[model samples]
Each structure stands twice: as C-alpha cells, then as structure tokens.
Target: MTLHRTAILCLTLTAGAASAEQLADLHLNIVPRTDAEAARIASVIAPTTDFTQPEKFEDNSAGAATVRPRANADAFSQASGNMSFERELDFKLGNGLFKKLWVSSPSSTLASDGLGPLYNARSCQRCHLKDGRGHPPETADDSAVSLLIRVSVPAPTAAEIEGYFATMPDPTYGGQIQDFGIAGHPAEATVNVTYSEEAVALSDGEVAHLRTPTFTLTNPGYGAFRDDLMISPRIAPQMIGLGLLEAIPAADILANADPDDADGDGISGKAQIVMSAVYDQPMLGRFGLKAGKPSIWEQSAGAFAGDIGISTTLHPAGYGDCTEAQTACRTAPDGATEVHDNAEIGDDGLTLVTFYSQNLGVPARRDLNNTQVLRGKQVFYETGCIDCHTPKHVTHRLEDQPEQSFQLIWPYSDLLLHDMGPGLADKRPDGRADGQEWRTPPLWGIGLTQQVSGHSNFLHDGRARSLLEAVLWHGGEAAPHRQAVIDMPKPDRDALIRFLESL
Candidate 1:
C-alpha cells in the first residue's frame, strides 16, 4: 500500500479500536494551538459563575460565524457571518442543491435524477424545512415528510457487535422506512403514530402534559417485520452551528465523558465513536440523533442515500437502502454516469452541500439582559443542566475551515451520549448510543424553533410539544434535573424557560 493509504489505515484502526484518550488526530488539517493561545481559550471557555448579566460574547453563540437575529421564518437560512463573498457563492450553490428535487432515473434531468425506487423524501430540504427543526405529522392525513422511522434488528452474532455499536437493518424492510417510491416500485412502509397523554403536576399547581407516542408501521410493502425488530423515530433537527460543533476538539468532548460515573455527578456522558465514511477512520460521532455519523460530510452522504435515495461517492448504490431481497428495486436504473464520478451526486456536489451545512450561521442570543431571562439562566445553570448541556467550547484552529477555527462557540452541548432514561428511550442501539442514550443536542438556535419551523415540537421523535414537555421527559442521568424543575418555584421555572428562549 502507498504511504498515504497506510497512514489512513493506521488512523482508522487506532481511532476505532483504542480508548478515547488514545484517539489520534482525525482532523489532519488543523493548526496546533500555541501555549499562549491555549491559555486564553481555557480562560474564556471556563463555566461562568456570575449570572448578574450576560457574559462577554455570550450573544454570539457561533462566535464570528453567528448571524444577526432576523424577525422572520428565514432566520435560520443565513450563511456564516465570517464567510467571504467568494465562499458565499458556494454556500448559495449548496443551498440550491440542498433544495434540489430529484426524480426517477431515465428522466430528462441528468443532474437531478436517480431518486429511490423506494425512498423517504426527494431532497434534504424536505426533511429540514427552512433549515430548521422538522415536526411529526400533525394529523392522520398529514404525510410524514420530516419524520422517518429507522428499523433494525439485533445482531445474531457477537462479531457484529463492535463495542457499543451493534444492530443491523431489518431483513426485508432495510435500515429506514421509505414512505415514497417512484412509479412501478413499492415503497417500504407508511408510518402512523398514536399518542396517550399523562399530566404531571408541578410545584405551583401548573400541570404539564407529556405525550407517549406509539409508532406503528402500517401497510408494509414487503412483508411482516421481524418479531425482534427495533424501531426508532427521528425528527430532523435544526441546521445551525454544525461546523462549530464539528470543530470542537475530540479530547475536550471526551474529557466530559464519565461512562462509569467516576465524577459522581450523575451525568456520565459517553463519547460516540463511529467509522467515518469520508476519512475511512474512526471519529467522534457528533451528528445525528444517536450520534451515528462522525462528520458532516458522512452525515450528508448518508442522508442523500438514505433519505432521498440519491447515490453519492460515499454510498454508491443506485437503489439506496433497497436490499437484495427487493430484486426489482435493486435492478432499477440509476442516474450514475462517468461525468459525475460514477455516482448520482459526485464529490464536488457532496462537498458543496457539506460546506452549506457547515456554515449555517447560528443566530445571536436574544433578551440576554432581561430580568426574567437572567433569572432563568441562573435556574438553568444551578439545576445541573450544564452538566450534560455544556455551555461553551473552544474549537480547534483549522488551516482550512476558517469560519469554524479557533472560535469560542456556545453550542450548549458537550456532544457526548447520555442515558436520558427510559422515558425518552428509542429502544434502538445506534453506533455507540444505547437505547436510552442520546447526544445532548445543542441549544444554540433552539429558541427560534417555532419561528423558523412553524411549530414548537421538540425531542428526537417530535413527541415533546413544548420545551417544558421536552424537559419533563428527561430521565436517567437527568432525572434529578427534571425533578428539580418539577419542584422549583413557578416563577423560577418560567424564568428558566424564558432564558432558554433567549438562546
């Protein structure tokens, strides 16, 4: 093998096989931090104690990449604030590709064909509407455009169980349920959900209703699912500050991990490790609801193939998630050609989309100085929410990704997997995330969910109708925090929500 290939192989093996402390440099293009620069970063990233007023640069959650808050639904659609005009063009091009609608193969559009014989959505934008969070179908008639059901089965053998990462796609239905299919092809399945509500009384007689969602797969195209099939419902999270999240050093994230609860903090965040499709190496999984994909590129590639049924270099299969059992679907014509690097969407296309996703600018915090917001901020911090939802991190100085490099970003996430208790469990093991574990999603642009997504649904399965409902669903490691909220004074609880909205 060539030296470059050997190096890559070694990196892949070492990162995947070794402990978190032994993690090698997965991002090779980064510039190492100087001692003085490192000291400054350490000082700035320290958790704040004084909550009398907003801390310095607290409004700029994405640091230099944060955009000014807009008073419309397009708030989440801006490019990185620090990006150059030349790079802005690339971001727009990526936005176009992101919203590009694909059709079935043998169509006139050469650049946009090869849609799934069986698929979920036509484009990335379909799921992540307006670059914001996606909600579950509101009514029975409403289609599940943004919500997708992931189906997997238990590994029959121990060999397939690699560390915490174990589970394979259902034998007949494949990885995810595809609700849409081109003509002459059968779609995988249709998803339906029924919810039963339970009212929980709070400290000051305020009752919060939590919905328990029971997802059902009706009208299965192939056949009955396996008895032991594990299903997980996922809603597309908002797209902002992803690049900043990716730039956070793996060691810093791993430092927060206490899988054994060694710190006695009741917050044992575990690092989700997965093989990177882009680097061909093991990387810290920071994206996806379960922290499955390592990098934005890999996540985008997987979405392109899995969600849209569009082939990319990373996932070259033309039929997308179609298994060999679906002979007709597998034999379907694809949009692959030599000009497009033998995949429907080539490297250039994928790179452009990744760039667009990476630079989705986070909006600056709102109402940082409001008395109630400040009180809520204190409540949030004092309630131990910061134990898992870490507030600040200094990103690596990168030679290439200038927009995300060396910036102190407030993603409000440690990007580590935490067991959120069985109340919020999906009962599906994805990569390093167990059934009850989920990555602490960043709260940067969460306050604007209703403004941008046209709804206020939160959580992995969109079961939480409000932020408080989402908070009440927290279990396991966050049970104490949840109880604290439940037992807090009504004014303090209201302030806490106000502070979260200011984010």
Candidate 2:
C-alpha cells in the first residue's frame, strides 16, 4: 500500500474518537460499497480535467491578438545570401562574440567582458542543457549542476510592519548567492544540512518514520549574516513553450482566479497578480513561483545580473555586496546598463540568446497510443489528479512560423499557486504568495528527465527521491487527491505511475 493508506486510517480514527454527543451530530456512510457499487464510487472520482482548455483563455486580453508571422520577412527566403545570414546569426548567438557576452566563456577574462565575478554556472546551457529538464543530486556529495536558488524577504511580524517599513528589507546578497567565484577570490558561501528524527503512526498500527531537515551555513565568508534573513532555493525549470505562455492574455489568467472558492468545487484557483517593473503595468504573472516578473526578457536580464553579477540593459548595477577582506571584488568595475547600445557588444547577443530560449521546441509525446498509457490516463483522471494537473493547452501562433501556428499542446500544469502545506513551506514571503504556496510545475518531458538530468530528485528542493515519494510528500490542498491515490488498487496505482512515465 502507498503512504496515504496510513493517512486515511488516521483520519478514520480521529473521526471515531469524538465524544458521544459530537458523534451523534456527525453524519457517516458506514456501509462499505460492493464491487459494482465500488465502480460507481470510482465513477464519481472524475477524470483529471484539462484546466488549460479554451474556457481558461477565453477572457484573456491578448487573446484577441492573433499571433502573426515574424516582422523579419527577408530572413526566411531560400536565397544563399539569406541562408548565410541565418547561419551567421545562429553562429553569432550560439558560439560567436554574442555568446561570449551573454554566456560566461570559461577561457575568457572577467575584464574582457561577459565572464562573472560571482556566478552559479559559466553558461546558460550549463544549467539547462539543450533547454531540457535539470535533475537533482543523486548522492549527497555529488557536484550540483542544475539547482534551484530561492530568494525571499523575511516575514514581518504585525508589530514590525506597523512600526517600521511597509515591507521586509532585501537581503545583502541580492536575490541569489553565487557560491563559485573566478580563479582569484574565495567562493561566496557553502550550504550544508543535518537531519533530525521524526515519527508518525500509520493506520496499520505501524510507525512510518522520516527525518526533518535543518540547514546551516559554514565559514560565513561574508560575516555575521542575519539569523532571520529570508532564503529561497529553487531548481532551474525546463524552458519550453515559455513564449506561448507569455502570449497568453492576462484576462485569460484572471478569469481562472477563483480565490474565494466561489465555484464550490473545493479547489480555489487563484491568480498571482504582480507589477512588472519592465512593462510598468500590473500584469498576470505566469512565470516564476509568484509570477512576479512578466516576460522572458525581464527574466533573462534579472538572471544575468542576479545570478552572474553581470549587468545588462534591464539591470545596470552589478551585485552590490562587499567586505574589506574582499578588496579585489570590491575594485571590479560595475557593468554599465547601456553597454549594449554604446559598447562593442550590443544587445544583439542577449536578444538571440533569448530567442533561442523562447523558441526551444517541446518534444513530441512518446507513448500516447499504448494500452498501459491509455489506461493510465483514465486512472489519472478518475483519481481526481486532473483537478490540479490539467492536461492540455493550445499554443497561440508564433508570428515567425506558419507551420507552428495554433498548435494544440499538452503541458500539464494549471500555473496557479496551491497551498502545499508545512512539509514544503520555506517560511518566507514572495510577492503575493504565502510561504506554504507553490506554483504547479508542468509535467511535460518528465519521462526523459532521468535520461537528460541523470538524477531522480523531484519537488522544489529535490527532497523527493522518486515520483512516488513526490506524491507521498504532497499535503495541504493535495491531501484529498493523495488519499484517493493511496486507496487505489495496486494494479491501478502502478498504471497511474506508468502513465506519468509516458509523459
């Protein structure tokens, strides 16, 4: 049986423990259903619905703007000169000077431009290989290639919020901490975790136990950091169909926000509305956990500046932390924002890189027609997993490609925040999201993750070791679905997991 069987039993026992008077007031379905009756019971467990259907996007503002072909027409001609220009542009973006500027070329000097004083990885491709999924560490001592770094403001108490600043102060380490440095300087910091034991009683009268994580920083390279400072760690997410997501109109997203559960479905899909500093407008955020930033342009610019300490048009200032001991780092020239317009290296490099990221195609589905897959899909929906993991969404047309227009896509995510319960909470506030909430991660290309990322870790911090573990770890809003999954027969449970692998 799955881990949830115990949870169901616990609930039953708690329900049974009420006082006689309280029990009299309670309603119960005491008789067990027969096999035919069980099938009827299962029928009520609705198939996972595709929440990304047409109705979800009908109200979007940009929904009315039909995707058009690229503004650059001459580039698509079959002429040799056009082909050559295309190749040249690709070369420039992929491996030329532009690549050197946007991506850190390990062999180049920091002073030569584009390399970093502080960085997580040297290149964009390092974390997101070929724009594919990033796996977590398989073993504790393993070198972390693709990892998520989280950032947050410390949660303010009511008293502090009333007396001082309206919001929590930003950390000295701007958003993220770049642990590795160029050859000369010491690395920024190191993270280590120690676990404490915890126990819980299961319905089978057995104790299923686990460990709790406690984090500590060693050799505080920066000195006396605040104990109550906010911290966020996030793994790099796959980059596919981001442009299509951006094309989705804000109205469509807002239409799905039923924050008060007005639909009475017991599931409230809320929207995280954020102010886009780049666009200078309140936009529906579809990216990031809190959906704080708007477009990929802003996301990329912020990553370059915050992750690598490299400045671009959007972020003019380099990372601003300094100590007397790190004199060389303090002396490095901060990159100017308008370097693209004025310096030899212009925005040409950054633009092409962004294009490549935005255009990385989602691979075609592999096992849709298989019997096991078909059955699994049925099981997935029947178990009510589809309530949140909505299956299909149609992409808006790409202006550049007539062939790629209006394609029906399947990215299994609702892109809404759900309370994930205390087990997953980092206890920090980000934008409009509380500590316990997280965006639903899309489940496309998940089957290929083990092959591409070379690890099985899942979830925000890579805590779950397998898909089963990931499901078992779900709580809060997912508790009901998790229970249903546990109560399923062994064959059906296996079928459901097989269905996930076929993704």
Candidate 3:
C-alpha cells in the first residue's frame, strides 16, 4: 500500500511542476515522448528523500542525467548532467577539438597547422589538463603550460572611465608574455618566481602560513619591457557548467549586485560590465579571472588567439600574439587567416569547440546526507559566508537552446566583483572591475580540484594551496566571514570544509 501510494503521489507531482520534470523523469525512468507530455510529467513530480528533496543534492546536480560520481581526475570533464542520454557523439566531437594539438604553419598537416609564431601551450588540454584547474609552478623549470602572466602598462588616460586609466598594450610584448614560439623564432623570455611565507595566528591558538609569489623575468629574448609594467599572474580554471553560468540571465545576476552596500550589509558585490567585441553592445562580463570577457564564444576565440596563438574569425591576425616589434614573426606563415578566409578556426570549428565547452557536466554532490556537511551548510549562512558565496539560482529560459534552458543551479557565487583587499589585488582594472576587485569565483567542483586537476591550488594565481588558505586570504568584504571561520572551533571549521567538499 505504501509503495503504491508513493508512486501515485509522484505521478501527480510530476504532472504539476514542469520545473522539476527533468529529475522526475530520471527518478521514475519514464520518458515522455511528446513535449506537452514531458512538461506535464515534469510539472507534477513529487519530492522524495532519496531524490526529490531540494537540498539532497545540488539543484543543478538533480537534473543532470549524465552525472558521474565514480569518475575522478575526469570529474569536471563530464558532459552536462542533464545532457540528453543520446547526444554523446557531439560531446566526443567537442572533446576532440579541445584536445587536438595545433602546429606552426608550413606544416604538412593542413587541418592542424597555424599554431603560433608566439604562444603559451600547444593545445587547450595542456593548460586545463583533465578539464580542471591549472596549478602554479612548483619549480622554475616547470613548464607553465597551465600558468601564464598578463603584462600591461597603465593607460595614460582612462579609455572610458574617468580617474581610471585603462590598460595599454606594450609596444613590444603586447597584452601577454608568450614564452614559446615556432622553431625559427626565439621564445619571448624566461620567467622565474619565488614565494615568501606570511604567518597568521588564528583565534583558536592555531596558525596558518600563507605564501606570496614574486615574479621576475630573465634572459629577455624579445627586448626590455615597460619600466611601469603591471604584471598579473593567472592560471586556467575548470570548464564545467560554463554554459549554465553564461545562461544565467544578466538581469538575474544584477538582482544580486550591491555595489554600494545599499542594503546595509557590509558585502558590496558589483557586476563587471564590459562592451562586447562580438556584439558591439555592453554586456555583463562573466568569464576570465577578472570577468574581462562577455560571452563564452568570445572567451573561446580570445583563448584561441592569446593562449595558443591560433587566429580565429574574431582575431584574424596571422601573426598570433606577435606585435609590430617582431617583424619576422608577423611575416611568418599563417594558416587561419591567410589560407582559411581570414580565419584559421572557421565557424564550424568554433561552434563545435564552443558546443563541447558548454556541455561539460558538473559532478553530483556526494555525502549530501552527512551530518557534518549539514552543520557546515548552516554555518556557511550564519557566519555571513553566504553573503558573497551566494547559493541557489533558477536559470533563465532560452528557446532553442535546450542544453542551457531553464534549470535550477547552485554555483555558490554571485558572479560579481568584490574588493578582496590588498592580499589578492592584481592592481589591474578590467572593464568596470577595479584593481582590487575580482569576480567571486564559483565554488562548484572546487572540491574535486585535486582529483581532476592533480592539484588543490586556488584563487586567481593558485597561491592558496588549500581551501582554508584561500579563505584566510579574504579581506575587504569577506573579512568578517574569514574571521568567523578562524574563530570557530576546529570541529565547526571541519564541518564547514565538509560542507564545501560536498559541493
């Protein structure tokens, strides 16, 4: 009787709330053949302890049909949890483009040539290994395949904003310092980094040591850089749920913006707005360390141009990453623009690659019923951690974009900029983000960083080797939350970490 009653109730719920339909179908193993039927079944699906409870698993994790719990080192590499069960071939195609190695022009391989006159890594997978976060160099000789330094000199006059000078590209170095080049060309320069340890005594009589890195250049192959060179270090972040994040409507994102702390809360989360190169209209910047780029499409094209030195339709230059100062490099052969109608990676390539990027699945939450995680979840909210690391968002509806259509998600971020104080400041402005400000990075899949990326380093530069170190370094708006964590008993702190790991 109990089993029979529950089934009938679930059927009723599934037919009532279309928003919960994806999971209802998963739990019931019933596929509605027609759109109308599917919506009805999804609408009425009732909640259950094992499946339907809102907090039982992450909201996005609930609807993810392809959720992989057993796979690690590849956790962040899965297709969207809700990815149609039958569309794996498209996923594989995107994965191929993601891992394909680009080569220099004048090569026998027509499809793969046009790698670089100057570049960082040969392929996307070189940096975002296993589709996870990149780590800082452990040693000077370590190939910084995953790490790159962004160089700029102050813009004498603010490009658009008053009292704020935008970045000016170095006449010789350009926007970034590329350390690798084709065989005939010399590598740009050698980079060396050293860390100085700073210690902090917690209220619990425990101490945490923080490492700060200082970068130095040696054996300049290009030439001298600007005396006022503003250098910023950035490492590649994970590539899961990017489409979902991008799908989160700009209006929904702005609904969380509190730039003036207008609500009397100390946390001031400001949205970073930048004019889009692709659209020529101002759009919210959602990707990159500083939230510098607007759309996933542009971000991908920018990476193709900047990181691998492969020119695409957006960046049609044949001399990838080469400035006018480098004459031989610019004149060198280029396949993307020279041979491929002014674009090495044509529309097809970009579409396939972008499609693959958009579908990377977020792994399901583990141990959601665990007691420690539950306690930490509460502490996360009570101690004001939720103020900045916001949770819960119902994504927007996008017609014809089924992969990224209406769905509930929990990215644990406001996706807005916050002043992180001096400890984390790159002192470089991007669009509306100030030097000390950075977009609050989403915390989903952060727990699996070591499993996926082979490292647990965090923050924009990967300086925080552990999550706690990342927390302790917080200041400005997040200072109070940091203080709360430090003041908590070891058990509570452990519980908080447990909650984060469950994500």
The prediction achieving the highest lDDT against the true structure is 1
Q: 2 or 3, which is superior by lDDT?
A: 3
| Tens-digit lDDT track of model 3 for 176-223 | 888898899988887777899989887668889999987777777788
TM-score of 2: 0.72
Q: lDDT for each of the candidates?
A: 0.86, 0.52, 0.73
Give one digit per residue, the lDDT tens place, for model 2 in 405-443.
343445567777778788888776665567777777777
Which 10 successive residues of model 2 have the least lDDT summed? 1-10
Root-mean-square deviation of Cα positions for candidate 3 versus the true structure, in angstroms? 9.7
Model 2 scores a C-alpha lDDT of 0.52
TM-score on alpha carbons, each prediction: 0.96, 0.72, 0.87
Candidate 2: list runs displaced more than 4 Å: 1-112, 135-140, 155-171, 194-213, 320-330, 334-339, 342-345, 397-404
Error of 1 at 207 (Å): 0.9
Q: TM-score: which is higher, 2 or 3?
A: 3
Report the CA-based lDDT of candidate 3 relative to the real structure.
0.73
